[model samples]
Target: MAHKKLQRFQEIKTFPNVFEMPENMAQRWTKHFNNQHPLVLELACGKGEYTVGLARLYPENNYIGVDIKGNRIWRGALTALNEDLHNVAFLRTPIEQIQQYFFPNSVDAIWITFPDPQLRLSKAKKRLTHPRFLRLYQQILQPNGVVYLKTDSPNLYQFTKTVINLFGLELLQDYDNLYAATNLLPEHTIKTHYEQLDIAQSNRIHFLAFKLNQTLPIEKDVELKKLIEIHGTD
Candidate 1:
């Protein structure tokens, strides 16, 4: 089924090296956007379900779906093109190097959906909500930018909650089972492909939202050298 999906959307807009985006391209992007629009980024954005949906729902805001898989992002890119959506874009890249592409305080919000938990203790730094990645997110996000996360892993949810609390960040919402929540906005409650599958299987879906406060203390960087010594370089 995943293979068929990839085959269907093969000929769509895709970047070969999203992380190494040129400085000139950045200038061009700034010129194209004129710095007047709000930018939302969806990290590890698979097929860009949220990105396309947001483009349709909030035409005033611009959305970018960042992911490493070209085939996965093709569907979202094609959707934007087919719909003539001027507010959406797609970038194919590893999420870890996101800071290389976006300017500081350029992003207004972020959506993270169904990311791998990287469950090994030694791989903690590779997690999207880890201190290192959070630092990168802080560099790109606006002062009051919000982050939304949806995942099926209870461990990831607990780890993220702990990290947020430890850093004194505010948690807007934390639900172990999102479908059970009656208060979510209709727009905010839409599920992604993976999310819908999980729901159909009677699996609990976790979700959380939090604001980025510039005043909060950033956590100390994890020692990558030590991590490497313990886990070896992958």
Candidate 2:
């Protein structure tokens, strides 16, 4: 199984712990690439298609793929290691706990690919773009940094768009059909594993890109906490 494969990879090399104090992040991260490069994170990076592809595309930036499932991220980590890619790394942790790891304004950008929709109304807080996660991202992402979401779920696409609009944040792009347009740049045209699967099946891919507006007045944190407590029970 995938989990077993990940466990094997974990045994080979212990991943650095990012959940430590903020002062430690630079030491840990910079040890690999130093401070001159920008940092990018891929949340819920399943199989690491985007992480690997992007790292290949942007050698000047450092890429880190964060996911709780070690098995899921093993492919990405191994690929980076095998390719001797100095600019890409993998972090094994829950995406919700991301704020506890990085310092304020530390990351330059974020890519969220095929995240779960958490479709039920009661499960809204669990969505990656929900206010709680957004706040966490704000704490780590640089002021002008952006978050990119690519998925096949229409509900999630609409829900995230609505949230961005309600919060008065800028929506740079809302592509309901990304591949239909002819002007796609090479950087944007590279596909993830899931995206490739979808393409082969002739399915439309939805994408949203938005910048982080630090000045926006976010609602109380208690709302998300309450939602998590009420709906997160297994």
RMSD per model, one decimal: 5.3, 5.0
Q: List candidate 2 stretches off by more than 4 Å.
A: 6-9, 12-23, 196-202, 214-234
lDDT of 2 by residue, 43-116 (tens): 99877878888999989998888887666676777787778777888777788778766778889999998887
Highest-scoring model, TM-score: 2
Clashing pairs in 2: none
Error of 1 at 108 (Å): 0.5
Tens-digit per-residue lDDT, 12-71, candidate 1: 534321222345454455565555688899998888898889888888898888988777
Task: Mark the 10 consecutive residues where model 2 has the least summed lDDT.
Answer: 15-24
Q: Candidate 2: TM-score?
A: 0.83
True-structure RMSD for candidate 1: 5.3
TM-score of each: 0.81, 0.83
In candidate 2, residue 48 scores what lDDT?
81
